[model samples]
Target: MAGVESAFPTKRLSVPTADPQPSFLVFGAPRIEEAEIAEVEACLRSGWLGTGPRVAQFEQDFARWRGVTPSRVAAVNSCTAALHVSMVAANLEPESEVITTPLTFCATVNAILHAGLTPVLADVDPHTQNIDPAAIEAAITPRTRAILPVHFAGRPCDMDRIMAIANKHGLVVVEDCAHAIESEFRGRPVGTFGDFGCFSFYVTKNVVTGEGGMILGRHEESIARARILALHGMSKDAWHRFSDQGYRHYQVVECGFKYNMMDLQAAIGIHQLARVEANWQRRRQLWERYDQDLAGLPLQLPPPPEPDTRHGYHLYTVMIDETRCGIGRDGFLEAMNTARIGTGVHYLSVPEHPYYQQRFGWRPDQWPHAVRLGRQTVSLPLSPAMSHADLARVIEAVHGLIPA
Candidate 1:
């Protein structure tokens, strides 16, 4: 609460700024183009639509993007699966403690639970909306085996500091890069600094794969095991086992899950990854435009990206404190919906959810910064698919909704 500002001085609009657009503007809509459509069509026609050539190609392309070798990357079904499989592949001991940010999506914590490890939460920095390095340091314990830091809103966490802390304590670093495909810190890519970096390609993600994820690991052996663990722990995946050359026999060496990415999903991801930079630039433009247009309003726009770091430009989130803006966060969301515009709350602090609160016996007050930020934060429409006119409508709606 000390770091979060609940009020800001600004004026209210006397009348509506503009009428709502005829069609609803979807939030976080990915820019799916003809290239993706064509690739998907080609995949369907090829008939190898499961875990096959396309998924392998996507892994190679993603590895190149992250500056990692193909052997160090594995494509999975979702970031959640990536995180879980990575943890299992890392050989973390049962009941070990994993410290992570409380301000992230529940999947970050659930992955820890699914891995048979206990999750420990550290508060986040309200300004950067990232896991505070100091909080992570304080959260360490004798049983602590790793730290999972989410790059909230696509802003890279303080990896330099986080990795340093991990090194000091001999803890594994697993980066939750769900919002950070194109992000970097101090000239290094995000997933490279950690032992394992998990990425998301959900429909609304910077790179849309309908539903897919990738793991970028530092060690080849660990990543190879991760690949095995992702697809039923078999000695050979389906493609290798039943190729045109021969029908090879296989063995199940370890218990695993059905988390492998399908060729169909990878088909879309391939084109999406190819256009990642172009899409990021478009989102960056939209983000800057929003900052400029909404500066005069009573809202807390995202802080500027740190110097020497490349923000992924994933989600453009703003804090809408009721005391300052005369409208609660939910009220603003409803108002946007009524205006035929979609919006989102990036998250409610992990403790705010009933399941987590009950399971962990946690309370919102334990992480005051996360609770405060989560309650007031709203994700605006920052998709690369949006046109200039769409952006204008969002800004006008925000300006028009200010209570007098």
Candidate 2:
């Protein structure tokens, strides 16, 4: 497929003389409703606000949504926690290397370090901003035990190629689906393709939990292990120990982290999951609007979903052409802020971060595509909560900044 920059010709848009938007448009706001609020209030009143019935129900609901068995999912506090637990479940040896894309959140790499594993950076595909399978193949080494592919901006990664490479190398696959709750590739969900699929339900995610995540997998034993590891390695969960069966003593089977999700967050998630499809549809409409409105400017819009796939439309990111636009990505961001519109940088590649550069001795030149993307990419406001007026304001602000 052609890269995003060459996918469309830049069209010239007329500049507007109107004053900037009067109010600040916050990016990625959760579409909270009375149902969410009432559920949370009920959870608080029940006083079983910890990981109880609500969390369990949320996990089951999530599993059902993903077409997976309930036992294959483990709910946690954050995607980072889910990733860490996944690493443990995979049983990666200390110092084992995991090949992953540089175009991802720090947490994606941090989880590897936390698991006592080395993270080997692979560059991303220019078009999708997702880890390229060829880059992953080249990064593989004798010590490489896994491949962590991130579904960038809710677009499914090329999982078929990734699975083939993993199978050839006998490597585990842990999918980072933080932006892909509703994403599917070739009729299957993104998370189910890997040994472990880590999902985020952060406030900005397609599904809002305020703060939560879930791990999905096919291995019953791995999922069981993750459940134990997510809650301080207890053999029996709180609910199991204090349920109708009276106080049953629990055992500390192994060293684990406190990463369990609470009912308060899960209360929001329960309703959020129920409305996820509806919310995704709304986001798709907004994404289409942005694509239509922002065309012809000196910017490269996000590529369309791959064939036979469903996009979650979690984020609508664009790449600015500094030379053509007369402003760099940072400059564009500042202009948007001045115009009372909120914007975000999905990420600067992992190698660009000082810690990774110094610790791993990585250079930006090592990953040309990721470096270019890191320099130019910008995430525009995209959410089901955004109104048509909000969309218009964003379009007007962006067009006003770039010359026709």
Give a tens-digit lDDT track for model 2, residues 281-301.
Answer: 999999999989888787888
C-alpha-based local distance difference test score of model 1? 0.93
Q: Candidate 2, TM-score vs. the true structure? A: 0.94
**Candidate 1 local lDDT, 1-404, one digit each (tens):** 67455475467668857855589888888899999899999999998999999999999999888777899999999999999999999899999999999998989999999999999999999899899999999999899999999999899999989999999999999999999999999988888899999999999999999999999999999999999999889989999988897999999999999999999999999999999999999999999999999999889999999999999988889899898999999999999999989998988999999998888899899999999999999999988899999999999999998742
lDDT of 1 at 59: 91
RMSD of 1: 11.7
- Model 2 RMSD, rounded to 1 decimal: 12.0
RMSD to truth, every model:
11.7, 12.0
Cα deviation of 211, candidate 2, in Å? 0.8
**Candidate 2 Cα misplacement greater than 4 A, ranges:** 1-21
